[model samples]
Target chain A: MSAEGDEAIQRLIALMARLPGLGPRSARRAVLQLVKKKGALLLPLAEAMREVAETARECVNCGNIATRDLCEICADPKRRTGQICVVEDVADLWAMERAQVFRGRYHVLGGTLSALDAVGPEELRIPRLVERVREEEASEIILALAATIDGQTTAHYIADQLPGTSVTSLAQGVPVGGELDYLDDGTITAALKARRAL
Target chain B: MSAEGDEAIQRLIALMARLPGLGPRSARRAVLQLVKKKGALLLPLAEAMREVAETARECVNCGNIATRDLCEICADPKRRTGQICVVEDVADLWAMERAQVFRGRYHVLGGTLSALDAVGPEELRIPRLVERVREEEASEIILALAATIDGQTTAHYIADQLPGTSVTSLAQGVPVGGELDYLDDGTITAALKARRAL
Candidate 1:
């Protein structure tokens, strides 16, 4: 490789390595594949990346990503079920959307309250969420946060802030298709305590 | 997500899925990360992708990736060692380059001769390789193909075509750190047969 070509390829590989899952080795392989299929894969991927870079934006009302001021779920009139699903990030909102169970709006907190990172309610969209509860007149606020300590702390903080609203959380039990052998002690105990009629 | 935002994210995910190592789930995760870190990752990655898409090209002489007509190795005056390492694809060439053992030029065949796939010498760069050998007055041609059946067949065919030129192949034995217990039967056999004195 010439110096210029090598530099370009190295820059691409380095950028790719910074992605969520890809490492240096995998990034090199991905770059090689991209270079090999320039016309078919690389060009289209470049175009798509450019397009997303230009259009993707966060919704003003909620933290969900959208191209406009309001996200689709918030903008749609029929989705107004007087409920809002609160998540730690946009990925969680997408997962909830994929389930197609929640016919309501979403409020992304961007991150959970972490004492170690010094991330508090103000750092997230918690204040905006409280304002949305009043403006939208939401009857219920679903806390779809993780089961981690920070997740629980954030959930409790939000619950305390909302006095009149009904605050709920996702059920903690034996997950669907979860094997009993793989279950931890805490999970087994929780599953036994939350056992219901079959 | 609004319709436009959803479309852009979906398109980006689809394009990411077309990459060699990524699937639907990982593609979604990668796209989410890209969207989340737009200013830091997505925009820069998009710019890099566009740069590569515009500049990256195949070397006219050796089929290696380059921005210009000749790849760096072929263009460099110091690398003229009168020896050419022949590989099945550019990936193999890259692997060889990573080892930094071979100082000679390379000839990428694009693919091997596969009767099942109807691939022949004409389909690969076999003709161009023969021309390069005669024109460059190369003393040796290293057949660094895989240990597969097609690889052996192509090696033999190329050897038959080059009667006067010295032809060699990569050693077929247990890898450097490979254990006898973990090695396959064929590899163990090859290693035993190719054993040398300490």
Candidate 2:
């Protein structure tokens, strides 16, 4: 590479390295591949990213990413099932959607309440969630947050805020294909305590 | 994500999945991070890719990537050491440069000759390499190709094409940090045969 375009390539690699699962070496390899297949990969990717940057925004009602003020779920009248699934992030909401079981709307907290990081309800959009539940007259609130202490604390706080709504959580037990030997002590205990009549 | 921006995000993820070392799952994760940090990562990466798409081109002389007609190594007067290191790809040239040991110019062949793949000498710039060695009056031609069968065959063919010039290959031995127990039989045999006195 020469002085003219080398900096651009290096900058791309550095930004790519900052992505979630990529490091410096993989970033370099990816950049080289992009350069090699400029027409097939590089240009199209650039255009796609540009379009996303221009249009993507958080939905006003649910915090899910959308091009408009409301996400698909929030905009659709059929999804008003009076049920709200509370999650830590948009990615978690997407995961729940992919499962095809959740037919209601979502409430993205953005993050859990963390005392050490000084993150509270205001920082996470929790106040918005509380207001949304009341305004929407949701019948049930499902906590799809992580099993961490902070996640549970946030869930409890939300439940307390919504006194009349029924609150539930995803079951904690052995996964479908999980083996007993590989299971952690907490999971095994939970599974045993929640054993069915089978 | 909604209909308006979902396609753009999905297109970015598909393009990212095509990159080397990235699968669909990692591509989704990377795209999420880019969307989350749009100003810091997404827009900058898009700009960088666009710049590279406009300026990056293969070096006319050596097949190395460059903004100008000639790559930095090929254009540098100090690199005219009458020694042309032959590599199978531009990545190999960059690897040699990273070591900072080779002070000579390079010739990237683009790929090794493979009869199975119908890649002839003409397809890999072999004729150009021959003409270059003769025109430049190169003293030594260093073969920095892989140790694979096709690589050795290509090296031998190149040596035969330029009988007058001294041609040498990288030494076959245990890698700097490789364990002897982990070495294959062929490498062990080659190391024993090429053993030097202490």
Candidate 3:
């Protein structure tokens, strides 16, 4: 390859390496495969990226991504079930959707409050979530956050803000299909303490 | 997300899954990350993909990818060292370049001969390689193919085509930093058979 071509490929590899799962070595292999299957994989991916880049936007109501001011879930009148699921990020919102159980709206906080990083409610969408809860007249708010300190702190803060609305959290116990031997001591204790009739 | 946004993201994920080393699950994660960091990763990657898609091409002389008629290694006047390294694909050529050794030009065969797949010399760049050897007055040809049955058969076939030039192959032995305990029986036997004094 010419110097220019090498530079272009190198630039591409560098960019691909920044992706979530791919590293430099795998990125190179991906680029090679893309080049080999130019019409099938590379060109289509490029077009998709361009399209998404031009159209994808954050929803003004929920912080979920959409091609318009409001995301699909927010726009759907049927989804407004007077229940809002609060999550840390859009990925979490997508995960909830994948479960196909949640029929209500969502509020993506972008991230949890981190005092060490100087992140506050202003940095996240906490204020927006509070405003939505009141304006939308939500009856209940489900905090589907991670089992981390920051996640718990954010959940408590949101609960404190919504005095009239009922706020609950997802159950914490052994994961379904998980083996007892694989679970940690804390999870075992929690599961034993929360034991109920099966 | 809205229906349109979901469609675009789903399309991007499907395309990303087609790349080597990426599966449907990982592709979904990657697409989410790309959307989340649009300005930092997604847009720039789209631009790079477009640039490479428009400029990258194959070297007519050696079957290597380049932005021009001839690849950089073939175009370099100093690389005409009367030795051409024949490889199975452009990935191998790039790997050799990454090693920063082997200063000679290369001939990418696209693929090796496969009896089961109905592939033969005509399907590869065998005839082109013969012409290159004669035209360039090459004194040696190094076969850096995989240590597979089909790869060996292709190497022998190429060697038979050029009687005057001295043909060699990459050493088949334990890989660098590879433990003897982890090597297969065949590799250990080959290494023992080809043992030499240090």
Model 1 CA deviation exceeding 4 Å by range: A1-5, A173-198, B1-5, B172-198
lDDT of each prediction vs. the true structure? Answer: 0.77, 0.76, 0.77
Question: How far does residue B133 in candidate 1 sit from its true spot (Å)?
Answer: 0.8
Instruction: Report the C-alpha lDDT of model 1 over B1-198, residue by residue, as the tens digit.
Output: 432237878888988988767887678789889988889989888888888889888799988888788888888898866889888876667666655556789998988899999999999899999999999999888886776778879988998888799887765674543322233445534543443311
Task: Give the top-scoring candidate (lDDT).
Answer: 3
Model 3: what TM-score for its first chain?
A: 0.85
For model 1, report DockQ: 0.48
lDDT of 3 by residue, B63-162 (tens): 9888788888888898856888888887667656654457788999999899999998998989999999999899888876766777879989998999
Clashing pairs in 2: none
How accurate locally is residue A100 in candidate 1, as Cα lDDT from 0 to 100? Answer: 50
Give residue A26's lDDT in candidate 2 (0 to 100). 78
Model 3 score (lDDT) = 0.77
Per-residue lDDT of B111 in model 1:
89
Model 2 docking category:
medium
